[model samples]
Target: MGLRYSNKINKIRTFALSLVFIGILIMYIGIFFRQYPIIMVICMILGLLAVIGSTVVYFFIGMLSTKAIPVTCPSCEKPTKVLGRVDACMHCDQPLTMDRSLEGHDFDESYNSKKHSKTKA
Candidate 1:
């Protein structure tokens, strides 16, 4: 078995989308507790919070993505955004790196961490 890698921005966006679905599911589940007013209210409130959290996450990622470096993927020749030192091409799964020292190395998400870089140095 081999590990799979995906674009960080896409991953985050997927997570946010899932959160919206989860929030809706929670709210739907609350409908069954209509007889228990307190429990129903609690569930509704929790669901609302989850949806709100998702909104915030979407907004934050959108802002962060705007700051990401735009580069053309060598494999696909399509434009994509790189979030950190190492990120897979958004269009193709080709591993990419901004640091020359990291070139030719196996793809590892840990390389994006400050602690990992410090230890490597």
Candidate 2:
């Protein structure tokens, strides 16, 4: 199967959503431990923390969105946000890059790493 690439912001949002679902699932599982009040309380508290963490993550993404560069995807002609040196078009999954030297090179997410920048230097 071919590899799938997603926009960075979308990936983070998905993680935040998963955290919410996981938190709910944990709380639901705690219902089975009704006989042990201590375990139930612990589970409930942990679940609440997860839900709160997700809220923080969502807020962080909102802040990042403001800093992200808005560009029109050439392939889709749709406006999208690019978060780093390389990002996929949100609408079309087409890989995009801001670095001219990296253009036409294979799309590798490692290109965004500090090590990659040092290599270029």
Candidate 3:
């Protein structure tokens, strides 16, 4: 199968959502350890931490998204946010870039790295 690309913001959001689900699953599993109060409590605490971590991640991503550059996707003609030098269109998954020099080149996420930019210069 070919490599699949998705918007960075969407990917992060999905990860956060998965974290929430995982946290819930862990809490559910803890229910089976009712006889062992220590184990159950441990599991419950871990699950709570995971859920809290997900909330933090969501908040961080939301803030970053607000600062992202807004642009209309050429392929979809829909407004989307670009998180870095290179990102996929949220609506159409079209490869995008903010730098003219990098245009037409392969879409590489490394372009967003400071080391890459220094090397290019």
Candidate 4:
């Protein structure tokens, strides 16, 4: 397939990592605004919020883990978690689906957009 699909857990992990990096960058920027204590404080708070948000996201992932379907990836021969109706193998990035109807279809991220599905239905 032309489309590349990544594991849902991996995607969330990447998002968490980006949030952390962005938080640090924002906090660093606040250092440059030392002359304006108020702006610096606000920046610091915002940066803290980002980091905290990432923490919450991480927690949410943990909660999702309990609900994820555990399956062995055929391509990677590794155990992975499949979230929702469609997900990819965490180790090998192999597209997987719980729905039989979606089987053999080209992997598309749009499948995850329920609004798109609703409109089509």
Per-model clash counts, in order, read 0, 0, 0, 0
> How much does candidate 4 score in TM-score?
0.86
Off by over 4 Å in 1: 119-121
After superposition, the stretches of candidate 4 with alpha carbons farther than 4 Å from their true spots are: 113-121
lDDT of 2 by residue, 1-121 (tens): 5666889999999999999999998998898999999999998998999999999999999999999999999999999999888999998898988888899899899998999988876
Candidate 3, 17-110: lDDT as tens digits: 9999999999989999999999999989999989999999999999999999999999999999999889999988899998888989988888
lDDT of each: 0.91, 0.92, 0.92, 0.86
Tell how far residue 91 is off in model 3, in angstroms. 1.3
Candidate 1's TM-score:
0.93
lDDT tens digits, residue span 12-121, model 1:
99999999999888999999999999889888988899899999999999999999999999999999999999999887778888888899889999999998788766
Q: Residue 66 of model 2: what lDDT?
A: 97
Ranking by lDDT: 2, 3, 1, 4
Per-residue lDDT of 26-77 in model 4, one digit per residue for the tens? 9999999999999999989999999998998898888988889999998879
Higher-ranked by lDDT: 3 or 4: 3
TM-score of each: 0.93, 0.94, 0.95, 0.86
Model 2 lDDT-worst window of ten: 1-10
**Best-first order by TM-score:** 3, 2, 1, 4
